[model samples]
Target chain A: MTKKNSEAWKKKYEESGLRDADFSSISGRLLEPLYTWEDLAGSDPETRLGWPGDYPYTRGVHPSMYRGKLWTMRQFAGMGTPDQTNERYRFLLDKGQTGLSVAFDNPTLYGLDSDHPLAAGEVGKTGVAVDTLADMERLFAGIPLDRVSTSMTINAPAAWIFAMFLANAENHGIPFARLQGTLQNDILKEYIAQKEWIFPPEPHLRLITDLMVFCRDHVPQWNTISISGYHIREAGSTAAQELAFTLADGFCYVEHALKAGMDIDEFAPRLSFFFNSHLDFFEEIAKLRAARRIWARHMKKRYKAKSPRSWLCRFHVQTAGCSLTAQQPEINVVRTALEALAGVLGGCQSLHTNSMDEALALPSEKAVEIALRTQQINAFESGVATVIDPLGGSYYVERLTRDLEEEAERYFKRIDALGGVVRAIEQGFFQREITRAAYEYQMGLSRRKKILVGVNEFVNTGRRLEIPVLEIDESIERDQIRRLAEIKERRDNQAVRGRLEALRKAAAGSENLIPPLLEAARVHAALGEISEALVKVFGEYREQPFY
Target chain B: MAEQRIKVIIAKPGLDGHDRGAKVVARALVEAGMEVVYLGLQQTPESIVRAAVEEDADVVGISILSGAHMTHFRRIKELMDGQGLGDRLLTGGGIIPTKDQAKLKEIGVEKVFGPGDDLQEIIDYIRHWRAAQAR
Candidate 1:
């Protein structure tokens, strides 16, 4: 009957000239018209979905998912210098933000300093720039280190950045045991999608494992990693691919730690996930629901994680930036609002809405606030958060969630066939899948099958109203470079070199690189210097371009 | 002798690692029957200019997402001028706002392909510009 309904819908679509119309995106995942128990044949809904916070917990993670506590209203924001980022931090905190998430500038992401030769023209151009302990100190200026959970979005030099963060907090009267926040120390996503990497994979994995072990020992409040699918979706992956590949990356990280002799309960409790809520409304929600079920089942059955906290697959969701259009920029606000609503309905732990103006540039302060308010309205006004997984029992939603789960499971089998994430990454499996998805999405858009409101349909002509944009001063780069040089002149060169050499020794040996890194950051050895030592020891990573 | 196809070097010239645009543009050029050499991220203007010369590319295309287009394009232009390769075709593609696009043209960037600009249009522009120069 559902098949017949889908066929009828397809027929109606065809009769309405959707065949000639651009039905590529809207029609890609052909849905069956009316789903019944037959659509969920051979499946026990109760056992599969279970009760809230139960095993194979497809219904919802928490017994009181949002009724107990509303999701974290954390929007990813940071730009210009660390000082500039601090001002934004205080602004967000004052405006009811509950978390502190830092976005490192491009040079910082690549383990380069503001003064490095390659960093010359790019310091503080993309995100916030942090070079040394002082820069990290200034970034947190007046904010209390122990009070807020700070998440730093840095890879490659995640160890160095986390080290500086630890040093800064220690100086600010916070103990290691009190550290709370997440570091996006997921290197798989870097190699797979974001491409901000320094050392080769093996050594990089070692550093990541070190962070996991050290944090497990010291910072119990800290989430040591957020295996990110946000970038995978940003790189244009299908929902199934994003779900499968991200969890696969998580599984690989677990296996790495497990092999390093860490207990499943010790580290798994702090593991967190990050996802992208794309413009496809029901599909994005279904992806999140399916992800929770998949992660929960995998942990229980495969790893035998003893703790319920380990079973709880908490994730932060960001509305898709790739979905925003440059042609009709304002409509992106509506698109982001819908996507944010899906995140809420999908039971995301935290949400970040993309500003409408993001396709053209970094959002203006007003645009970012509006994006935040979009989430706020959904929370306080829309009243969607009052219910946990409100759409869970809907036959349509439940089936879609199952369909996404099965499809993602198929992808998992294929990755397993390819011998897991590392082999697949080396073989460029993730890269190939995402590139194909990106191509297909663009093809849909170009064929005029996907109606991007401001771009293709319901056009707004004669609107020359200029929105205020974030104008970056070119002098920021020069200023940053000069500051880096001054820091270079003051720091003891021999001490810095000594710490870096010790870092390299640790890297080349069996020792975890974090302690040496913290020591290096304490002495003001720049992030770039620490990375350069590892690069010398491990060599620079060069990825082969995909054909 | 067979006519040598137009060669284009598409480079991602800055710190932004979002290469979907760069990769898509590279594929478009390949589909257009051009020999395209894609120099991936963290490329200095020196590296780009050198690659253009080494590949003997007829056109050099720079894709920026780090929003440092003004400084990056200026550096490329300066390097091109100093190396006496100013006559070589230069173009850029990315999220160039209208105001910045205008300023970029003023700074001697041959053409600017902002978001949603057609790949076919770019190929046509490069062809027509080269033809006009020949005339």
Candidate 2:
């Protein structure tokens, strides 16, 4: 009966005269014209999907999902000097943003002070520059450290930046136990995709393990690492690759932490994930579902974690920045809404919607407000969050979820054969895969196989959309450098030297680097100085150009 | 005599790690049968200029997405002129704004590409510039 019904539908589909276009998912997965029970053949829903908040959580991580608590609307915002970024943070908080996700400047991300030579043109270009704990203090001035949750997007210098945050909170009289936030301390993805690393993989992993251990004991509420696939997807990976590579990186961290003699349940609960909500709606949804299932199963069966909290795979999602167009940029609002919706339906714990003007420049206040309002409308107006796992039982989504799980398992086996994530990275495996995928996507665009509205298709060659882009003044760099120099002159140079020497000594020994880092932060030691001391012990990493 | 193939040096200046565009454009240049040299990430202006002079390349294309195009382009152009490679074309692409692109042109940057630009258009621009220089 099922076969006969499928045959009849296929006959009608053939005669329907649909447009001759690619009907595949963005990840190039071919989809049938219709899906039915036969698509989910031999797969028991109880074992494959299970209940929400149960073992192998594919429906959703929580029993209540968003019905209990809505996802945090955290817009990643930072620019110019610390004072300026502080004002922006205040503005976001005043405008009802639930959380603060800091976007550090490139120099800061590279562990460079504003006065460094390589930091000449990049002082405050991409995000805010925090040269020292003084800068961090000013960045969070007037903000309640005990109340609001902050997420810092720094990797290589994560320990240093995070130490500064802890020191600043201490100065504000907030204990480490009361602090709540997350740090993007995922260095594996940095090596694989983001290309922002200061040390080799071994030393980098050591820093991460130290941070994880420190946060687990000192700051129990803090999320030590947000294992990210956002950069992997932004670097031009398919949905399945992003899913597989990200989960593989997460598993590598778990394995490393377990090897460090730490209990699995102790650190696993603090491990969160960040993923890119790209243009593929159902594909992204399926990938997120598969991620939760894979992570839960691994934690329970593979790693032998006893706690249910350790089995939960909570994640944050950001709409794809690569999907925004430079041409009629306002149309990006529509694109972001759909992607953000997919993230919501995929059961993200937090969401960040990309601004329309991001393709041209940093988003202006108006543009950012519109982007945040998109989320507000989705939460308040749209009925998606009212129900848990709205698309859980759909045959198409279920089939896609299983397919993505198998795809990720295959990648896991391949990575294991290559001796794991770091070895695969050194062998240029991930780089080659991403390059091939990026090139293919670009080729598809050039060949007119893919249609990007207002870019490749629906060309607006006759006119241009005039949108306001937030401009960072040239004086921002000068002012930031001046501030750093002033702090250096006023601070006790003797104490700075002593702290940095202690840090260097600790780096050479088997000690947690966070204590020394926090000491240096307390002395107002510059980020560059601390980083240099560590880089002396842990050499630098250089990548071979793969194109 | 066989025509000289256009040689281009594609470099990423500054500390931004968004190299997907740079690598894609570099691969496209190679497929277009041009002699291309790709200088990977964390490149300084001096290093980029030195490579350009050493490669004796006719075109230097940079990709900057960290909003540092103004400082980078100005400094690189200045170094290129000071090093006596002023006649070579300097072009690039990124998330650069229209006004910044105009200012870049005033500093002798040939063109600045943005998202959604066709690869064929960039290839044609380089070939046409080389043809003009030859004339």
True contacts kept of each: 0.44, 0.77
| Per-residue C-alpha lDDT of model 1 across residues A1-547, encoded as one tens digit per residue | 5678777776886676434443223326876545665666777878878887786667677789888888888878878877788898898898888888888888899998887777766788778888899899999999987888888788889989999999998888899998788999999998899999997787888888999999987888999899999999888788888898899999999999999999999999889999999888888888899999999989978999988778878899999988887776887899999999999888888888999888788888889889888988999999898877888777778888998899988988999999888889899999988887777776666556676666556666767446777877778878777777889899998999899999889888898888999999998888888888888889988888653
Tens digit of lDDT per residue, candidate 2, span A116-189? 98888888888999999899999999999899999999999999999999999999999999999999999999
lDDT of 1 at A226: 95
The top-ranked prediction according to lDDT is 2
Interface RMSD of 1: 1.8
Clashing pairs in 1: A2-A34, A5-A33, A6-A33, A22-A449
Identify the runs in model 2 with alpha carbons over 4 angstroms from their true place. Answer: none
Q: Across the candidates, what are chain A's individual TM-scores? A: 0.95, 0.99
Give me the candidate number with maximum TM-score. 2
DockQ: which candidate is best?
A: 2
Q: For all the predictions, what are the DockQ values?
A: 0.57, 0.84
In model 2, residue pairs whose N, Cα or C atoms come closer than 3 Å (at least 3 residues apart or on different chains), thus clashing, are none
Lowest lDDT block of 10, candidate 1 chain A: A18-27
